[model samples]
Target: MAVSQTADTEELMTCLRIQLYHPEPQNIFSSLPMDNRLKQEAEDPVRLGRAAEACPFVLNDTKVSRKQLALMAFRVPGSTEMRFHVQNLSRKGRLQVNGIELRHLVGAELPDKALIRFGRYEMLVLREPGDSETHFEVLFERRIVAPSQEMGEGEARTVPVMESEDVTLSWREPINEPSESDEYQNC
Candidate 1:
């Protein structure tokens, strides 16, 4: 029983990690808290912004426009196995990879070691090295109690486990191809 519980806990471990970086002025290192539950519950495309109260990963880029949505991360569809794709959410700030603008690229594959910059902030996207199960399910256990010497009440039943699957707002648009732009060239 203990071994099975341990395996379950390990299964809940984070599969992906997003590291934050900034230039000389804002040199800070931080990792976003990403868990299996958050990934499983998130919509197709995950939204990110600067607003602490709004975005899943609240970015602290003062140079970023307050009205901009910042960025969007999503899992590629049409296959059982999928990789993450990142796109710029703001039209003002360009998402650059290797000093090249990402305005033309459909979506940059994540878990990439290339330097990523937007506004005054830079980021490194990485994945944890481990075997992970793609299937996700929530389990529930129920229990019943009888009135003998334990309880004064006649008969009582309790739900020891409960699973919730309510879908919340992810503030993300459906993953799609980028529009044609003559201004920015492909990187």
Candidate 2:
């Protein structure tokens, strides 16, 4: 009976592979590399922040708060499939998953493939069906389209660009100019 229970526990284990990228490599700080890989098991929630002692995956940036966020793994009732959720922990630095923004203490279910951005750093999170074995892979960079190619030839127009690799302009609505009160919200 004990053996059967251990097997069941092992079967519920899942792995997450996070590949970090810096869009502006030249401007990146010396502490942050251009591309990095981090792998973790879904057993415990993983914390991410600027503090090395508190977070296993340390993001060394001034814009990043001491406690930025956490990723937790869970399984739905009556299902063996593992799922992940992200919680924003920083009161100042907002977290962006895909194209949606999450404020402090807010959490959302993470997709199998998600583009996460915080503190000028971007990471691609991929869910894998397995134990805590480590894996690494390179992520594709966002393609830059010239303004002239996307807009009408004669008319001068400005387009809002989302830095995430998975997001496209087609579905995104144009953002209005920020008000005076909204300007300092992120600060």
Candidate 3:
């Protein structure tokens, strides 16, 4: 009985581990290596709430500032998209990337096409009316990229991932050029 109990304990441990650490498909992102994401189910209500909120309508920027949004970071999300989507509940506001107005940013999936080519473009969203001011400064950061008298560094190089169209095509040239056109030209 003692040996059997020890065997059962080992099996239970193995089963629990598999449940806790399933990978692939939708892998959970974490700052921890050994820590199981399942164990973090009860960690933060606010964060969970934010994720839930953001996933549907709030789904835009991974992080949002509650204060002055003086700086914008229009970096390529990967080797792909250079624009990031943001939801501004601030009412009557202007968001500009490197002085380029972000009116191009719309829809949940479409970020502004103009904001699509910056290593890290800086933006300033000025709220003129409605909502509140407390939201601006708390969420804002310094220019995403520092502006200098040396402006050469500000040139945008990031390309939008979604805007890329497949241009690779194969064409079959006329095996005998003039078989049709040349015979007609003789007339």
Top candidate by TM-score: 2
- lDDT per residue for candidate 2 within 1-187, as digits (tens), equals 3366555353323556665655554433344332443344546577778787776656657677888888887676886677678888899988776656777888777767666768656666766654432222222233233232333423212222233353332212333557666655775
What does candidate 1's lDDT look like per residue over 61-164, in tens digits? 56664333333333445643334456666657676543435552234554423345566554444433332335222111111221111322221112111122
Q: Model 3: per-residue lDDT, tens digit, 79-177?
A: 322222332222234333333333322212223222311222232222111122112111222232433212444443222222336312111121233
**Which portions of model 2 show Cα errors greater than 4 Å?**
1-13, 26-41, 131-187
Q: Return the candidate ranking by lDDT, descending.
A: 2, 1, 3
Q: Which scores greater on lDDT, model 1 or model 2?
A: 2
Please report, in order, the local distance difference test score of every candidate based on alpha carbons: 0.40, 0.58, 0.24
Compare candidates 1 and 2 on TM-score and give the better one.
Answer: 2
Root-mean-square deviation of Cα positions for candidate 2 versus the true structure, in angstroms: 10.9
The TM-score of predicted model 3 comes to: 0.20
Error of 3 at 63 (Å): 20
Name model 3 segments beyond 4 Å from true.
1-84, 103-187
* lDDT score of residue 18 within candidate 3: 11
Please give the lDDT score at residue 99 for candidate 2: 55
Candidate number with greatest lDDT? 2
The worst-scoring run of ten residues by lDDT in candidate 2 lies at 134-143
TM-score for all models, in order of appearance: 0.47, 0.57, 0.20
